[model samples]
Target: MNTVYIGLGANLNAPEAQLRNALDALSKSQELTLAQVSSFYASKPMGPQDQPDYVNAVAKLTTQLSAIDVLDLLQQIELQHGRVRKAERWGPRTLDLDILLYNDAQIATQRLTVPHYGLCEREFVVFPLLEIAPKLTLPGGQALADIAASLPHNGLTAISQYDEAASLA
Candidate 1:
């Protein structure tokens, strides 16, 4: 099985509810087993400030699928929750599911990239990721704690926590 980490964010159509619905969809997938989920946080938008802030969280899972397959699954989940592909980079969306890491493997293709393109500097991702694995190190050997220390908190505030045991079942 491949251990994977997923980053979740939503800022439209009842953001928190969209996140929970996406989590439930992922937990029900047969190809993967949901492990732990981090507490939710709300942060300033990464793109144009004219948009609403995002609700973000991270999830750790064990999957039997390949990197591309996992990306495909994530896209499916996003679509199910009303995510549409817009040309605006980092624009607001109904849901965003990114494959942060896939068993520490570095994968780069036109469709996806692991160790997600902008993870190192994003407090929203790093902080939530730390909740599940404080000692995590990327495939490049960068310690997560070290990365966290390097970045500013960036106004991310916890909105809610997840109960792993309750959600796992």
Candidate 2:
């Protein structure tokens, strides 16, 4: 089995609920097992301040599927949650699911990038990821704690705990 970390974010259609529903779906998948979840966080939008702030979290999972297959599954879940293909980048959406790390593999293809391009700079991704895996080392050999220490909070705040009421199980 391969261990993967997924970054989840949403700023539309009840962002928290959307994340919960997405987590539920991931937990139900036979191909993957949802192992750990970070606390839900609210953060400023990355691109375009006009949009609502986003809710973000990171989840850990163990899966038998390959990275590409995992990407496909995440996209499917996004579509099921009403994600639309948009020409604009960082626009608000009902859900955004990204593969942050796939078993310490550095993947770069037309469709995906592992360790996610924004993982180091994005406080929303960094802090929550640190919450679940504090001592994690990135594929590039960078310590997750070191990355977390360098990023400012950027108004990111933990809004709620996962596996409590947020999982929607």
Model 1: weakest 10-residue lDDT segment is 160-169
Can you write out model 1's per-residue Cα lDDT over 31-134, one digit (the tens) per residue? 98999989999999997999999999999999889989998999999999999999889898999999999997998889888889998989999999998899
* Colliding residue pairs in candidate 2: none
Off by over 4 Å in 1: 163-169
Q: How does model 1 fare in lDDT?
A: 0.91
Worst 10 residues of 2 by lDDT: 160-169
Q: Each candidate's root-mean-square deviation in Å?
A: 1.6, 1.3
Candidate number with greatest lDDT: 2
Question: How close is every model to the real structure, measured as TM-score?
Answer: 0.95, 0.97
Cα lDDT tens digits for candidate 2, 49-126: 999999999999999999999999999999999999799999999999999999989999999998799899999999
Pairs clashing within candidate 1: none
